[model samples]
Target: MDYQIARHNMVENQVRANKVTDPLVIAAMEEVPRELFLPESKKGVAYVDEDISIGNGRYAIEPMVIARMMQIAEIETTDVALVIGAGFGYSSALLSRVAETVVAIESDATMVEKAEKILQDNNYDNVIVVEGDVVAGYPKQSPYNVIMFDGAVAEVPEAILAQLAEGGRLLAVVREAHKVGVARLYEREHGVIGHRDLFDANVPYLPGFEPVESFVF
Candidate 1:
């Protein structure tokens, strides 16, 4: 069996079950080659309805979770997007279909190199994969209309909030211990307003974003 049939089944059953009705996201999952982002051994697991292990204890976000975040972000063709933990650039490629330009950042050098190669090979010129610890957010390319964290995090840092353009939105799956929840946060005029609990699901945690420290007596 090929990934095409599996991917389609995934979109219809798993993704649609999670309320991912965006036609664009569904189409991307069907057309984009998910296996191309995996190692040979894990190629068979590409359409397995879960994260693809990419080494360093990291994994790409499940397709349905990505679709959930992207759908709530309400992507626009002209919006500039910042994708944290780009893995092998699959999300960046999909985001490029909606966002005008995509800044795909990964803290791992090997993943960065691999993402760049994959993107170049696929002719994804609108995306730039950077190697850096910009998990909080990439400042050099600040003021993005959309910021999507492919993995779950304990908190959304101000560094990432600062990167959002006025009225821009940041979408992430936040983990509080055993719980995992999705949020779509907007940078409002005075402050940020988040509409959390879009759904409850499991996603791998992003590195470098552990919970903030608290004072002790």
Candidate 2:
């Protein structure tokens, strides 16, 4: 299907056109074979500017959304990263290119298996897919230089924020109630974690991250 051409077009038209200016981010998006990360039935449409479901209530978020998040995080070559809700491990693969090491957490067993296989087969050796509770954030490897939520969440848990290194940055699409989501970049400076809205996003919520229901009068 001429994936190379399709990939080039996706970078130039969907990602680059949307203000994802970081050269490393652009290069990673251009180099990764996103099609390999999707179900066979969805591969033909891999480069489309929309999320593609990968079963088990997970979606491979739109390329532009992830690209922008990476750029905002400003990942460094020697940083350690943790990706919550790794899904098919596409985002982790992208992080592996820019970060020294990556630990991806996924709750679903099937997903963890598939993600690990795909990553290993493709020689993305810097990333490891761990099967565990997604919202727990792999604290075993605390003090991550970068933490990314692969999907939208109602809130960012303090436990997750605690994993960020003093100068680390975390990125997530925060959606509350039914309102539109906001992509936020959280930074830890002087032991304080603060966040600023980067852009508006409306992507699927990672399982286990849904807001708790409240009682009504």
User: Which candidate should be chosen as best, given lDDT against the real structure?
Assistant: 2
TM-score of each: 0.90, 0.98
**What are the C-alpha RMSDs, in order, of all predicted structures?**
2.2, 0.8
lDDT of each: 0.81, 0.94
What's the C-alpha lDDT at position 57 in model 2?
87
lDDT per residue for candidate 1 within 22-57, as digits (tens), equals 887777777778888877788888877788788887
TM-score of 2: 0.98
Look at candidate 2 and tell me the lDDT of residue 65.
95
> What are the per-residue Cα lDDT tens digits for candidate 2 across 1-217?
9999999999999999999999999999999999999999999999999988999889999999999999988999999999999898899999999999999999999999999999999999999899998888999988899999989999999999999999999999999977899999999999999889989999999888887778899
The candidate 2 region of ten consecutive residues with least summed lDDT is: 206-215
Which segments of candidate 1 are over 4 A away from where they belong? 190-195, 212-217
Q: Give the Å error, residue 192, model 2.
A: 0.7
lDDT, residue 143, model 1: 85
Please tell me which predicted candidate would have the highest TM-score against the true structure.
2
Residue 106, candidate 2: alpha-carbon lDDT: 95
